[model samples]
Target: MSDSPSSWPDLATLRDRIDDIDRQLQVLINQRAECAQQVAQSKMAAEGDDTHFYRPEREAQVLRQIMERNQGPLSSEEIARLFREIMSSCLALERPIKVAYLGPEGTFTQQAALKHFGHGAISVPMTAIDEVFREVEAGAVDYGVVPVENSTEGVISHTLDSFMDSSLQICGEVVLRIHQHLMVGENSRPDKISTIYSHASSLAQCRKWLDAHYPHAERVAMPSNAEAARKVKGEWHSAAIAGDMAAELYGLTRLAEKIEDTPDNSTRFLIIGRQEVPPSGDDKTSLMVSMRNQPGALFEVLDPFHRHGVDMTRIESRPSHTGVWNYVFFIDFKGHTASSNVQQVLQDIGEKAADLKILGAYPRGVL
Candidate 1:
């Protein structure tokens, strides 16, 4: 039976229904906020006045549960994001977290930070990745977010190197899908863009696209994409290849959208903090292993993971700071460090490796 306009509720009635739902949502949200407040009180009572209110594992679990149980018109990611904002607001009622990211603002690292911590968090921008680590280590910020690797451009070696010098633990991770855009200022002539600015990795990511479209344009690599966007704002004949955030921040118009060579380009960012994150059921642990410069050293290090049934997600070798010829392997694998098999694997690797540092075991990215 098809319902006609006369049988269906009028626009006014539909609006009234929406208003009623909104009111109910408001009440429920407040109730949730009150419960969060009570949680804060309980934590203070148990762990003194300086208690850490942010629980990465607990938040990850809650978000995962929300996504798993959601049966709605909204997508799982959308619902998870809504809950993320709610949790962020509730956490602010307890304690507002300050997060540092590699940026001069409008950088992807900043986007990743906001994506993970929500808009309620205070996000600070640092010029370099090491500065982000420094701020967190110095207690200037509660946490820091930095890019670890990109799907299109490969690993960020600077981030991995920073880990070697810092004691910050990876508390969480967030993966951002990279979508590069060709943006220009209002006065800029699209046909006369003589130079394009972007980070080296970004330039490389869009190499094929740029080669085909703007073959003669001079590609200048900048420190960050946001910086490139900023640089283009003053020049009429120059354009910038940046992300949506940067384009919006600088009021640049996108002449061309999604111009990356690869459609599935993405970057994985790590959340760094001072404290260890407890196990979330679905978690990944990152470790740095420095093996002796000997035959089968890599085999000995990786053999334990295979034997213990640990699934290795990634393995990247970086030049060891300790020696000229030596290399350190940055390994990421599924399973919490506290798990029996993971523990056994680590123990075995510890025996074989010259040095091993467990960066952290954090919940995998949820959105």
Candidate 2:
């Protein structure tokens, strides 16, 4: 009865179909949210606790189930990200989730925060890593995002150090693929470039490219790569090494892209909060321990993990900072604290450790 008997539907009809789908999606979302409210009621009645919001273990279990049952057309990581937003939204209806990250806005940390938590969240940016933890500990923000490690570099020691004494828990993690770009003002010339600016680490990461092309250019290190981009101008004959987000934020043009040392450069970020997340099926537990400065001491700390068949994902050591001639070991393993094998390892560590602390157990990143 329409003008599109043999052809595709008209624009208006197609638009109406989209609207119909939106209505259906809205209804399903509401139903899902109503179920979450019911869950809160059940928890309040059974546990006599009204403040229970995060369930890291339960979240992990859901992701694990999805990953295991995932079929073609959608990768496990993609499916998990979709569910993360769904769950984050369900929790938000009860309380708004506020997160703090190292930012002045538009930093990679900010992007990671948004990626992990959907647009339904409030994000606060701090100047330093310690400030991020401070905001979380003070209850000003619900969570904090800080870079943990990079594929090109090693780890962010400042972040690792902050966790040593902070009480905030690692609720989740988001991994961002870092693509460094050389950005400059629209009127700038590449051949006339004489100065390059960026964070010291970023500059170091792109050392090979800089050395090859900008041998005569003076490299400067700034507080942040974004800040460096902000400093570039039409007459400066300079560029900055920063993420694409920063270039967009500062209205700079990207002269080059993905100029890092390695093609697979990515940064892993941690989401810290006062509340613990329920286990998502795929979980990682992090810990820090102080061991005697003796031979086989490090191996002894690792032995229980091997015995329990737990997979060790990362292990790094830092000078104790508490005293001279002492060190602390930070280890990340593939299991939740609530798991039988992980529990057994922790029990063994309890009996054998000089000093130890479980930083937090969080969902392993997808993609």
Candidate 3:
């Protein structure tokens, strides 16, 4: 809108300088990768084959430092994302990590996995959330990414329930900003759309939007939005409500973009793995505690957290499978389990609660 190609007098000089910088950047990146390889070799030599190269806390710390030291035209998030790819690529040189996510393909969970681990990680799609957990538990994949909650629709019960039965620890978390789109295949006409398909959650998220735009179109629920996109590919009178990844994967064009009722709709995903992450200075701990069906049991259990000065982030209650009226509380708070105050709170809760499980303490989502 402003600068013309011919108007820039120093364009050639700037281009040459950029070329030089690119070369230098390439050299430095390779140097960092070489150093990563050496680190991998040393770890393997000292600890044998079981040496885990992926450290969630370490990566979180590195990315935080990158953002802290950054002074550039690019925003902090943009710069951190660039470094995330570099770290992902370098880690791949040591050992390619396999991540399992809930999907047929092209779901937001898949996108979140890629965002957290980068394109360098090998992402395998699981047909269901439980399958993703199973894959990680069975050692088929190094980690699993599953949606825990959405900003618009509240918590994902399936993910929380899965944690109730699993021994896997949460190693990391990814927060993805969701932008729902109405898409249709080439064979479909926007004016002719008589039906819309999406996951129950996505449909709920876009309820008002769909009502205003396509009032008469029948809304059908699918197992997942990506599946919805796939089912509509050959339908001449159907559209799917999904994200950009699904639209591109199914070769559909967006009829309407960001169609969710909430502009700030986003999803938080938990990274489930076998390993426990260390303290990252800034971290969050999640717990599952069960209490007897007593009147003051709830307050008695939670009072310790308030007394200890530990910041509680979230708490969700589900039926305790062991008893008729008993409940299990899934609690999240700021601070590591290793910290003294957190340990004290846990001890107090342990004395009162029937059972308690420390799900994991993980680095807060960086990007």
Give me the displacement of residue 79 in model 2, in angstroms. Answer: 5.4
Task: Give the C-alpha lDDT of model 3.
Answer: 0.94
For candidate 3, list the clashing residue pairs, or say none.
none
TM-score of each: 0.98, 0.86, 0.97
Q: Record all residue pairs in model 1 with backbone atoms less than 3 Å apart, i.e. clashing.
A: none
Q: lDDT value for candidate 1? A: 0.94
lDDT of 3 by residue, 1-367 (tens): 3597666758789999999999999999999999999999999999896899999999999999999999989988999999999999999999999999999799999999999999889999999889999999999999999999999999999999999899999998999999999999888998999999999999999999999999999999999999999999998899999998999999999999999999999999999999888899999999999998888988987899899999998999998778787789999999999999999999999999889999999999999
Model 1 ranges off by over 4 Å: 2-6
In candidate 2, how many Å is residue 233 off?
Answer: 5.4
TM-score of model number 2: 0.86
